[model samples]
Target: MRGDGSTPPRIPGPPVRGDGVEAIVAAGGLHNYQLELHAEYGPVVRFPLPGADLAVSVADPVLLEATAAINKRPEALFEFLTPLQESGNLQTLPAEEHIPWRRVMLSVLAGRPSHEAHFARFAELTSRTADRWADRAGDEPVELQKDLSELSLRMICEYALAGGLEPEEPGRVVAAFEDVLTEYLARLYQTDAPGTEDERRARAEEALTFLRATVDRVLAAYAERDDGPPERSDLVAALVAAGESPARIRDTVLMTLLAAHHTTGVAISWTLYLLARHPDAAERAAAEVDAVLGDRAAPDYGDLKRLTYLDMVLKEAMRLYPPGPYGAREATEDLTLGEYTVPAGTTIFYPFWAVHMNPEHWPDPEVFDPERFTPEASAGRHRLAYIPFGIGPRSCEGATLAMVEAELVLAMLLKRFRFRPAADRTITPIERFVLWAAEDIPMHLTPR
Candidate 1:
């Protein structure tokens, strides 16, 4: 808003012939659209989203402080995800409800006991995947995103289910999970018509049923285990212990699997892609991993903290290509940011990638420099300048788990192999609920 309590400058975007609707659609995706908008209109740009609603995109880290503690997400933007939840939408759950729900999630996801309990199994799955890649023909091309996505799905499934799933079950579960997301995303993106949508929803319904049944089987097995739920907690056991309803528990598990499948995998893929392109950085990461886990195939949970350079490389990759490109919050009350004010109910877009690229915060923002995250260089940076996981109370709860999973997998793979971009390939970053390669990230892997 202006000084006299008027609206802020109408952002300089494509003319409002259709409220900038056509232009937004033409700009490809919100990822590219926000990039173009911020470059032209400066840090704050108001642009049209899915429903022709004007949203303010804030790229400046200092300006973002006005919204750092907002706990509310925009209802309209998050409604698309409600269909996945029968009880309610996790993304748009009311603050009263979200607070407790987030607490439950954090306890399970961020718990050190949970990480310790699952670390061996997670490492085994990662080594198995890496060994398979090592066995492939030297010249055979690998789609890093596709392969890592499957591995991540299996890893998260085991972590969430806590050994309830049979060894053969993950492949089928991964297929069903992918099916459900594919159908829903088609509708969420408006890429399908009424008839096509109906069929897709039907398929999604079937896939959801399959997923719920699988979870039920796991829960039953978990209940019947002779060891009595093991010493460590998983998501299902924690939710069950909390006395959450069956539907609610199922929804939470489904949501976790849905959330984990792409994010952890994509983060690893991007990190590997970046490392492969920067051999000096890759060598440094490899050296650190080798030093930390000499003669071992994978790292012990305690070794994670010792692999410092690998952490920096992974953090730098996310800085360049965050798993999710943007996150939004709705103002519950009037707010002032810089010279402008935002009215209650206004949707404030946090374009994370743009925030990361702000010239004011990052000198040579386009360069992939891992040293940017070294403790000395990082100490002076604004806290929100590098929000790959997002901000506020609604930020990702699995951040600790994600970092552990990513660093361990990078250690396991980089210790045993060298990766290079496949010839004639380039990565185009696009938003699809998360930032993803417009095409699969193709690469060549050679055993060390």
Candidate 2:
């Protein structure tokens, strides 16, 4: 209620009927639905989300600040991930439990030492992918998402579980993880694919068993090591040292693998896709890469800082198409957002894509201009206006590492090849765990 004693403004939205599934479906998906809802009803809209009884979406960055401290996520929305976790669902953990866990994660994932420790392996993996792309340069267009997803998975494997597997084990791990994710995602989206539900579930279970055992093998190897744990930068080592249970450790690794790979992969792929559409940005990015690495093929850990334009390009691309388009938090107390008051227990939906497109903060929102991120342009802008990673305590802890991996890969790829969209393919954005292309982004690569 406002101090003026007049009734607060009623949050405007479409008439709430049924579970809102039909409305969401009609709008294409939740991402598009949010865009339409905000466009028609303004930044804050009360809508019936499928999983929650009452949901209010906030797209205004300034208004978003009011909900930032709410640490609890709506459990029903993330319930699908329960099967992958053993100790408990990491995504919906209570704030007390999540806080310490997040600290440990930040210590390893956010530190420069951790990134530098893993940089060489990351660079090597990117170079190998580039070599494979080089082989097929002119023959056929390359599927960026599929190949880059695998590469990101491999990089996370190296970062999470340092040096415990055999030479052939990494490939097996990648295959097993893919099997696990394929089944889970298919179930979530109800998309028909090559196999029966029972068959896919069995395969996912088998892959899950292998993955857990693999983590155990690494732990066993760590236990047997005469030298102490390699470094605090190693994720597994850090978790173990912090007295986390083995089950929690395994869940952490699985969750890390799940969160890190596809998002980073799609991020790089989308950046390249945008660059392909706008050749001028691509040229500027490429020229920056050239200046940063005159003779070297890849940027070192220190060099990522120097590739400022490439960084800006990546940030802008994410603004246009964030990897995870929306997120939700359950309000723990009555919250005042502008003139309206939201009661406790309301599901506060975060329409990240819509926030990026909000004309109030980002003028000419649809324009693919990288200069929006330059220092002068970014000055005095709302902090939450461009949240590619997400907002507040529940935000991605891997944000820093993701940037390093992306910039390095971009530098390596941009230095070696020029990416142009394939002639006939239409790249449509769809939400599968992340913002993915319905048909993978196919690009024609020519050696630079």
Report the number of the highest-TM-score candidate: 2
Reference-based lDDT, each prediction: 0.83, 0.89
**Over the stretch 296-349, how does candidate 2's per-residue lDDT look in tens digits?**
998889999999999999999999999989899999999999888999999999
Question: Which ranges in model 2 have alpha carbons more than 4 Å from their true place?
Answer: 1-4, 163-200
Best by lDDT: 2
Candidate 2 RMSD computed on C-alpha atoms after optimal superposition onto the true structure: 2.1
lDDT of 1 by residue, 305-369 (tens): 99988999999999999998899999999877776667788889999988988999999999999
Q: Number of backbone collisions per candidate, in order?
A: 1, 0
Per-candidate RMSD, Å: 2.3, 2.1
